[model samples]
Target: MLTTLIYRSHICEHFPPHDLKEMVNAANLKNGQADVTGILLFNGVHFFQLLEGPEESVFNIYQRICEDSRHYNVVEVFCDFAPHRRFGKAGMELFDLREYEREEVLQSVLNRGTSKYQLIYDDRALQFFRTFVEATEKENYFEIPPADSWAFVSDDNSVQSASLPAEITTECSFAFQPIVDPLAQKTVSLEALIRTSSGEGSAAFFSGLEGDEVYKADLKSKKTAFALAGAINVGARTLSINLLPMTLVRIPEAVNFLLEEIEVNGLVPEQIIVEFTENEVISRLEEFTSAVRQLKAAGIRVAIDHFGGGFAGLSLLAQFQPERIKINRELIRDVHKSGPRQAIVRAIIQCCASLEIMVSAVGVEKPEEWMWLESAGVSHFQGHLFAAPAFEGIPAVCWPEMLSAM
Candidate 1:
């Protein structure tokens, strides 16, 4: 469980190159004993470094780094978990970005790590850290990604419980609703809606779930979503599934479970869009954003579910861009008949368009409602008008014949 801490700051005016190396070398000696491995990059002005080791060791080193008088205005860029150490050792590797050519520095950073993509973040971060942390809450400095993103791949189903292990099976299930694009006359993606096997609905099924139960339920549904798609050989269209952001933070293994299952089901991360609802209050915006970044880094798309339904929905988008936004039904309903609603819907479409985000108009029931929304530049839609959600698997989308006339 190696945690990575990244920060950038300005080297004080007086420190010479020789003196800086001596200091870093001395720290490297001390860090090796603490099992920390990382790279320090100084570009003559700013000092950018990454620290990786046990969670406590990394944070302790960061605290010392923050207190050190050799550098001033130290800004923490990212604190995340690395699946494996990029450098593969317990000592500081120095890179003077100023002394070397761009290729040399990049190769040094990618050494022992994959060439595909490794999280050697922000040498791009000095300016971002300068602005990003200030504009957002400073307490956010403490949130880090999980220790190991693959730690929760529990295939050993041998549960020895007081009750029969078989009795511990989850009662919750899922139904999928397809998001349609009328202009293309094609079904776009399937959104997995949670349901109860007992026919009690999502509210009743998930009512008492808290802590680990929530994570278990989410992991189960996410796995099922992947399984269903694979079983049907669904195309590259996104399989949109709802995710509880806080649950990922609470137990990062939930994320690991999903990632593992994606491989098992012969699916790629690009085909999935994890949606967080607007109804849930974002108590820890920084934590939520970090989890989203982890997902994005894994090639998974993020979306805002039932958007514009809460204050946090639109306001939070300006900070971190998502791949999709499903317009809340309340705003989409009767939009053709209501001038204010249409205006609101238009503004949302424009905002999403500006961000280059796909907009899916959810709850499009009436033909008039669908017409106005399509004219307003929205191509993605889903609701009872197309077809009601079907349990166990995706139901056929009843494409309207009116689309042919149009």
Candidate 2:
């Protein structure tokens, strides 16, 4: 099988530049013997390389390269199988970006490609080259420490019983997970995640419901969420609850119901945020927009949950701007190591920033993921890395003792 691997890394500080020539010569000789061919680009401070050859040979060569002490913050940005090589002639070629002007560097690199036709047609690989040569994505490259640098400690000892009305108490329960600013060491909000009374997920809780009943139940569950938040006395801290978009349209006076519930539970409208998933289609757009206005007028904020996971993202952003957007887990997963994901997320952050909308990342499970998102200007985060959702209670969060001095 043929394999192609593309990775980038930062050159170690105080490293001698003269040794780069000797290192390239050794790599060329070794790779030639192993029947591997690739090109490496160095832009004074960072190295981008692509290796394409037999799967076993390329894998072995990459392992050796990773162990070299000359570079740090290694991120394997792309890996895939291809029918043929793009640079079949050279064992390993080095291009120092410092020697070439930015205007001609990409074309110069393409001039070295053995498969010029493939490079022109395959924009994926070519875009990576262009991005590296232009250095447009340099700002998003965050160097995170080893995963074990910090530990995640879960403290469920402070758990308090989530009191629910007797009628709906047996029907469902709530699990509260915090959205926190790790650097600030503060909880921005606690999201009330719906679950079965025995602690099953939302899927199990709504399995038997159908049609408008699902929307009704989705709206009704918030009453229990509010009661639980009040039970825990989430004073001053924002409480975020998920809601179906249609619930606001289908249920009469839905915003008024929410406002009344907020008062009854000893909470205020400003402290509540209603999150509507972007993936769900809002069948009645006009009505939904009006309801959103009502929500805002009542001092309750609106947010688009799972922002990038669906088709309605840009259109929804244009329709009625939400106060916040939670970048979906799919985009957040492995973002630190992915050039494409990093670019997309950076665009999302920029767009939201311009409109004065806050962006948060959800389902972030790795320290690397959190680091990248934090560096990209997202301050709020939710996921198991800090604290898992507590069943019928609030889970205590574990903050990193020391962040990397980047």
Candidate 3:
């Protein structure tokens, strides 16, 4: 299939301006060999490029561009299939926006198009070029430093020991990982991640279950999570637990059962947060919302987990705003180097901020990922970089400090 990928990046300081001509010449030869054609636009500060060709070739060339040391802060702006190429005339052409007047830049871009009809008709592609030339999206382009800019040091504190009551033992166990504000040096909350009694992850525990058994196991696991949290004396700090949305609908008196368990375990409902993964299909919305209402009524808070993994997250937010939302790991992985991910995360943060909702970045394992997220207005974080999940105990959190070089 014919595909088009658009991206923008800032030139590195070490990349001399005179070398741009040689770079364009090199790109022309390489792209020509792969039957690819596109245009590169430089607006003095940023380089916006479009690549179009066979799906594999386009992606392969784009990957090379990302690894190129000549530029940084690369953000993918648009990507999709096109019936025909817009810049089919060249292997790779250069359009220096610095040379044209603001009003003339748009016309210059249109004139380079392979098809006048395609250029006039393809509003999305044209608008992208126009936006770059007009310097309209500069405000949203956050240029974060490299991830290794700071050092993450783990505090070698011992995990607090707590005995689990015999009655609370179950087929599964709980692993605790803290969501911490590294700069503030405070643990915001500890998420009780479910695991098999054998110390396997949640997927292994759920793999054996089918149908309603899955929901039953999901709801039942939280009881153990609560017991574990209480044993550790979480005190006034909040405790987060994951729940499949359908579990609330499938299990009757689910909210009441949770309240009873919390009370019996010596934890207040106010300190509990039930995180619902967005990927699950809520076949019965009314019933699930009703259960969420009961949770809120009892002082328990609600949060959406895996916020961008599915289409339903925004709809869920519109229906009922949660106390916080965890941005999925897919978006957080190498986010400091990904422009598209950065844009999406920024949008999510802005939307949550407007609604008075908190946001957290989960599954972060890289210092760069955490640093970019922290700069993007996210304070609460859960990931291996801070602390890995410790089965039945709390793990020591890694705190961030400036490197001596800084």
Candidate 4:
């Protein structure tokens, strides 16, 4: 992204052609020498240019432009990446003032003799500019610039050179979502199963089940419950509730009902792990952390779900001090191929370990993956290859029975 500030006052219909020529020559020389290509749009009273090239070269040209006395009231209007050079050709092109009809109101404001560009300081003006540009692009009056194709290639090359394997999409299954204790070789009591719908009404489409449902068969079925009763009826002692950040902010009274039910059902506070998506949690760090801390004070365990992926922030995780961290499947899928990712996971585990916090690896389907995670000092594993999330209640049967059945 490159931005050049141009003095709006210097622009005039009767401005010296020689001065304009000098400015154009300087801009062209800089662009040519640095291999920077961009577009220039000049109205009778203002100039806006989009430049793209090596960061240093662009900055150097901008500095030179700032020192020129022919221009004043310089301001940067637009700046960002483009797919290809919109102004690939050499030389500056002056457009008729009518060409920028959309900016007429801004021009009027600037013509009023305002010392500062109102477009920069006025919120309404800023919004108008954004809207106008968007509308222009949508109407096809102006082509929306394409992002630099080299951007993705450079990113891919960097990842490749670091020996990180390309991301591979794997067929995920909900069959084995149970959390099993390896040492006891037993399905852990009060196991919390993470569930997601599939097909047309899948979470990817319709999202998880929500709303008030009467629980006719639970320990406290008559109570007005907030959770999806269907999961509870199936005998899940500890329910992992997936919450959006907004929902956490205005915690509904129904949540209190759910907590009441947990207590009535003889479930431990530690049994209930409120799983928060990475993006949702970190975005509203202060609010989410405050809510989590409040819940923790009440004896409920808070686990950050899908950690180290999406909008995951290590700093936020440390500050929040969640009870457990669930590692995303992406990092675990090919830890062997990506040393940096593996190192990241190891670092996270070490940090969590030092804080006495537990770590679980999600989407661990292969034996090799499990072995690698175990070697990495990960404590808990969940995915298919172990046992699917059961609709059945806590089995009267023990680990041996479950293993034999598997």
In the range 307-401, model 1's lDDT, one tens digit per residue, is: 88887756767877889998999988866544356557777888889899999989877766776677778899999877567765666665544
RMSD of each: 22.7, 3.6, 2.5, 19.9
Report the C-alpha lDDT of model 4 over 1-406, residue by residue, as the tens digit: 4332221223433456447656676777767888765544454544545555666777677666655555543433344443344345543443334445664744542333223433454443334333433333222111111112111111111101122112111211111134555535544323333222231211432233243211111112212121222223424434454455545555544346556766664554556767777877777778767766666766777777788888555776656777778888888884533334656788888888898888888777655456556667875777654543432222222121212222
What TM-score does prediction 1 earn?
Answer: 0.56
CA lDDT, every prediction?
0.69, 0.85, 0.85, 0.49
Q: Predict model 1's lDDT versus the native.
A: 0.69
Position 389, candidate 3: lDDT: 87
Q: Please list the residue runs of candidate 2 whose C-alpha ends up more than 4 Å from where it truly belongs after superposition.
A: 1-5, 13-35, 53-70, 76-84, 97-111, 115-124, 134-136, 148-157, 162-168, 281-284, 403-406
Tell me which of candidates 1 and 4 scores higher on lDDT. Answer: 1
What does candidate 3's lDDT look like per residue over 1-406, in tens digits? 9999999898988998778999999999999999999999987779999999999999999999998998987777888899888899999999898888877778888788886534474578778887888888887776767666777788875376467755456588888899999999899998998888888898998997999999998888888888878787778899999988888888878888899999998999899999988766345667778878888998999998999988775666787788989999999998876767888899899999999999999999988788778888999999989899887788887898887785
For each candidate, give its TM-score against the true structure: 0.56, 0.85, 0.90, 0.46
By TM-score: ranked, best first: 3, 2, 1, 4
Q: Which candidate's TM-score is highest? A: 3
Regions more than 4 Å wrong, model 4: 1-176, 189-239, 252-255, 392-406
Per-prediction count of colliding residue pairs? Answer: 0, 0, 2, 9
Question: Weakest 10 consecutive residues, lDDT, candidate 1?
Answer: 152-161
